[model samples]
Target: MLAKTPFIPDKPILIVCGHFGSGKTCVSVALALALKKSGKNVTLVDLDIVNPYFRAADAAELMKANGINCINPEFANTNVDIPSLGAEIHSVFVNAERDPDSVTILDVGGDSGAAALGRYRQMIERAGYNMLFVASKYRPLTDTASAALENLREIEYYSRLRCTHVVNNSNIGDETTQTYVENALDFGRELSELSGLPEAFTSVVKADFCPALAEKYPDKSFFFIDNTTRKLF
Candidate 1:
């Protein structure tokens, strides 16, 4: 543990953005728990406006139970597709600038989610942040490194923020097997190299897989977050 650097960053703000179906929301929730458990003041913002599907906000109860500050849109729990922005959404940025020891994670919807972030571009720029693009090889539009780079460019252009890292959250929910996890790390590493961005880590939902992961990819880091909610969408 002395030599192992944890997946959580020391930075105050982290933006998790990716193409639709890349599982950025799962990574966001997992990341919030990881940072909070590491002893940092942590807040999670559900800024995913495009996907009406269940998102980070859906894990509010679970997050709150674990002591993570969860900020969700007004209509996050409703059937409405209209994107709602609450003033509280800016609190994370405020904390980002004021609280150096705090960590804030923003789980964006998709490329469009990053586009919605355009409304807060000035604040985001002022607060300072590190954006991590989550990619999954099995997901459409990012199956290949070239395609992943293309998606990255599109999101960066819309958000006006460059990606600082990549997170390989390549999982097919409970169906994700060890073989898939192993393959994803390799694919994610390739994506990382092509994007000229470092991969923060690959995630596994089961803690039992850690030993096998360590044995197979001795050079990589990982996060084990068991999804606590059942998907309704």
Candidate 2:
């Protein structure tokens, strides 16, 4: 079971963005599952036109098994570089409005990847949405609080959406541990202070190493997920 984290955006429509290799895909997957567990019909869109690896499309089968709708690039899971998204991407918002109880989670491409999302700005902005920037201190360009804000501004400018919050997703691949998670909380706090955005929560993999820390930090919100989709360097 995922933690009842305060970072989970309660909006009916949400988008996740981050610098390349910041583990936003993992956060997106976990978010969709979390929303579903909360009893809302959830739809996850993978707008990762930047990196082909570590994308939400990779979890389509698993998401389907769990009753979550996933949208991805038309050429996803293939070698083709085509960045066109399927028409179904627009349906997420429509369906959400038609079914007030549904939630939509858009897994935006990384920094440069935000350019791909500019095309949908109208549809998304007109309906009003929140874009959550996923930040990891371990990643380049986001190692410091200042670097994080710079990247966030760029992502916001490209996506045409302001980020309402930040999600600290710093992790060292499969080697992540309790100590790393605790350290990430500090990083998250610094980022929140610097960026003027609330540190939504620390994201951790729901693997063998996380249980103790997760149980120990009851007040701190966390959104735990399966880390299999992460691109381990």
Candidate 3:
């Protein structure tokens, strides 16, 4: 069972953004699945026009099986680079606004992919949202605290929105170890301080690793994740 954490916001709109390979898509998929399992009417929007590979659309079958409504851009999973999205995307916002039990998860593309979200800024803001900026020290160009901060600002600028929380998602895929997760604690803290946003939680891929980490860092929260985005390959 996926444990629910504070990272799942009370707001109807939850936007997940991060540097490439920071695992934002995986986080988004996992969150959507968890919400569905918890009896919420969940909708996942793949707003990743920038990165053609590893999109939430790739997991459409799994999402459907789990009772999650998924919306992807029109040209997703093809060689075409057209960035057009479906008109149905509007219904997600409309439905969420009227339905309190509904939650929409936006798995934004990495880096400049957040720009795709700019056009929907007004609707998202009106419905209230919690934008989570995920940071991973293992990914290139965002390995340092300063670099991560710069990337966060770029996403915010492109989206025309501010991040309400920071999530430390540092990991090396299956190579992730407890030591790697522990090392990211400092990076997470630095990012929280620099951004002036609360550290929503640290996402740990290894479920068994959570108890020890939680005991050590009682002030911090950890979310256990299963790697659902890997099937995109």
Best by TM-score: 3
Clashing pairs in model 1, backbone N/Cα/C closer than 3 A: none
Candidate 2: the clashing residue pairs are: none
Compute the lDDT of residue 102 as modeled in candidate 3.
Answer: 93
lDDT of 2 by residue, 1-233 (tens): 66553444556788889898888888888878877877888898988887766689999988999999888889987977788888888897788568877778888888878987788888777666777889998886788878988999999888777899888888887787778777767788888898898877778765565667657887767767678574545
Q: What is the TM-score of each candidate against the true structure?
A: 0.92, 0.91, 0.95
Global fold similarity of model 2 (TM-score)? 0.91
lDDT (0 to 1) per candidate: 0.81, 0.80, 0.89
Of 1 and 3, the candidate ahead on lDDT is 3
Candidate 1 vs candidate 3: the TM-score winner is 3
Which of the two candidates, 2 or 3, achieves a greater TM-score against the reference?
3
